[model samples]
Target: MRTTASFHSYATNHRLVFGDISSDPKTAIAKANTINGGKNGPFRAFIVVGKVFTKNNFEEVNGALQDGSVSVDLPMFFTDGEGLPEDSATNQTDVVDIAPNVTFLNQWGRLMTDDFIIQNATSGSNDRKTAPTDILITDKWPSNLPRLSKVGFAVPQTAERATNNDKTIDATSKDASPLYHFSGSESFWEREPFANEAGKHTRFIGLAPFGGKQRWHYAFTLKKDDTSTPVNATECPYLKEDKVEEEPLKRANEDDGDPMAKKPRIAPSDCFLCLSNPNLAAHLVVSIGQESYMAMAKGPLLPGHVMLIPIKHNPDFCTESRPSTNPRHRHPVRFVSPKLALELRKYQIALKQMHPGGVVFYEIAKAKGVHVHQQAVPIPQEKINNVENLREFFIKEAKECGFRMENNGELRDDQTNYFRIEFPNSDPIVIKLNRQNPKFDVTWPRKLLAQWFFGNKERGDWRNCSQTEAEETEAADKIKGDFETFDFTR
Candidate 1:
């Protein structure tokens, strides 16, 4: 993970030296020193947008460090731009402190200045703790941010850039509002500080390689109210062009490049349950709802085994969590979203009404190939009294598997990795499993319990008892007959 260091109480008047010093560190240091009034200047830090040293200039850096010409007390933060070192050690960690005050901000690392939260351009892991800041520093500008129509920066080629370009920037939020965004592009570009319609200000500046005759140096004073009110994209002076470039009109006689030349839609590569693929058994859908749907299981664990899945692709059952207000609770409440929770409850009700024996709902929220789905296995009436015994068996099995079984009151949503809910208003049994351990199989506990319940190991797997197309259709028909009158809409 990328690390962040904040510098509080930094003087507003403190100057920040920004440039690419990879070609010549000696001259860069000399220029910085001169700009800071010959060594004792008011400069608080040096922000290097690109690499600090090139392949051929290693000796120059060595000489600069050996001569003690650079100030040791001043903080120097450098980001690895497009030109990253090939060494493995530098790429392994997010941030590395090479010297007392010299830090390398590996891609995506953040350096929190008094007035700005500077971040490099890299798709890092999600971190919710860091707060938004006034200015943002990145090597490559995010396409979601306001773009300059006249600027000559090369069009972004990354897939994320294309995806971000389709999203609207939320200018009102502090996380999106930045007074200045300094980046390093393929060419030199600059957009003078301008405010949008709502009075939010931003100055975009992109520096080319060092030593060009074109404009490179920029100086600005940090203001207290830099990001007070947010602005809209329409108000930005450098907003991108809205209309597409004109194209030659196609002749009426000629076919206009295949009237039906639209690309075919494809299912998500990660999700196997998406109904887009005709080859998949989506034809066996028993009942469809606004948020979720029910389908006959591919393999029957019982006479009427079925699965409930979300219409939209959800990675797992517990996708969101919130702090609980329960006065007696010691842990945060972990539950699905309101819509998903309601849908699950509805599915449980429908399944219980159809299967009088009993319904066992089990879910594993790990990174398994199995898309988020709850398995509803019907227990015969004779075996319904043994449900409590099965619950005890699960607890004992979980303990043997090194998982700490927690009561619903004690389990935090974030800590829960597995859970089982019995139909007819039974309490959910949450299990805290270690996600980091490779040997920790999330599907084992339920599979073992299912085997014990069914008395046959093969019964745990639905694929082992594959149903014929006609049988699947019959099952779907029966399920639909039972739930046709039920309300499953959002």
Candidate 2:
């Protein structure tokens, strides 16, 4: 894995140089001296996108380091490349200080200057705090980051030889990919720097490999405000379209040559909580939102017991890993969108207002056949004091269950295995459970508390006290009457 370190400073204009170099240290040093001699001389740094040292080139590298004429004054950074010798002292995470001002960026790392930020595409730990990056340099292009370049490069199937026809060029291009400089592929030339899709005047220049026939070196002046505008839909032209081919329909004659043959049908989900199934009591629905709906619990933990469930089937309120190609790849909160969050909050507020005794939102995300739902039970005014000890009890119970409690009560990494939120006031008390424990059940907290307060084991399970159609309808009518005026949309 590769890690990144960011350095930030303020400056009006900063000049940085970029180029590709091989194991020949003399050439690397000469290029630096040549750039120094130019009007844009004495650059902030020199970024080498290829191998800095080869297995048999230690003598030349050592001679360059010893010679004062070839000494590099500005910081020189280089990433991993083919033919580079492995340093026993430096690991993937550790950056090697080769010379006075030259640094090996390892497999993956980041370098930031007053004018720009440079990052490599190796997965690793990140510094707790960092600044935004301007330029991204990696061995292989990152599929997730904003595309700042108009040209796209991909390795051809036939690696024995490089061909221009194998590379696809899009003349009508638009993207915000940063000024990316990369090597290790077939060397190509760009006559002029191309502007980003955002029309921010930011440019991308691909540096050809060292000793290539065409241009191999690149240098440009960078301004503090040369940053790209945020990428929009039209700007991201590199997004791949999902091509799902429809399955061919089978002819009736194919099935034993019988036109009357019937196709196998999928059975409906047996879980009554799933709204899609016939077993679900639609009459119990109290309020419906875009992403979630509220319904009367099958068995009343209390008269106002309600379940908040997502409209779509979700196992739990935890962060899910999505493909990089997806625009919504980042983890969400309880719901996938802010609109869902607002809807849920509205219901919570309305429920609390209807039952001022106080509402306790509890969820057991690990239950079998569970369609993620939170059990919102209104606590009696007299039992409000007992609820204070509830947090302490659960903390002790979690420790006994062999799960360490995080100091912060908030969800960790968006994994909401078991959590209890007290309404009206106070922060939520969340418990991340150990999924490996077969004996552990997330529902135990709510079940035990219900037994202690209501003194009815049957009340803990909704199935134990199933309501008739008439009874469910009555409960739903009463809930709707109480909650209709409090709808957030209104």
lDDT of 1 by residue, 1-490 (tens): 2122222223344546465777666677667657655423445666666777776776556556656755444667778633445576477554667556677777645555433455544432221112234445554554444443444435435453344322112221223345666665545566545554224566667666566654445555556344454342234543333101001111111324442211112224323477654335665687777678888776567666788887765446655556669976554454567787788789888778777767777765532223578878777666787666776666676677666556562455342344444543466666543432223443464466556676745555333355656776787777667767663552
Instruction: Give the C-alpha lDDT of model 1.
Output: 0.55
TM-score between candidate 1 and the true structure: 0.40
lDDT of 2 by residue, 1-490 (tens): 2122111221133345445666465776777767665545556677777667666776667566757656876778777644445557455443567778877766545554434556554422221111123454545432222244444443323342233221112211222134443433344433124344323333444466666664557766554344444342224324432100000012221223332222112123433456686546687888777778899886576677898887756556531334345465442223245566667778888888887767878775531123568888888666776766656655666678775545666665434344454543555666544333334444466565566566644455443344656776888788888888876544
Error of 1 at 42 (Å): 89
Candidate 2, backbone clash total? 7
TM-scores of all models? Answer: 0.40, 0.40
True lDDT of residue 229, candidate 1:
41
Q: List the residue pairs that clash in candidate 2.
A: 2-123, 2-124, 147-176, 147-177, 148-176, 148-177, 148-178
Off by over 4 Å in 2: 1-271, 318-335, 366-370, 400-403, 414-424, 435-438, 455-458
- In model 1, which runs have C-alpha deviations exceeding 4 angstroms? 1-270, 318-335, 367-370, 409-411, 421-426, 435-442, 485-490
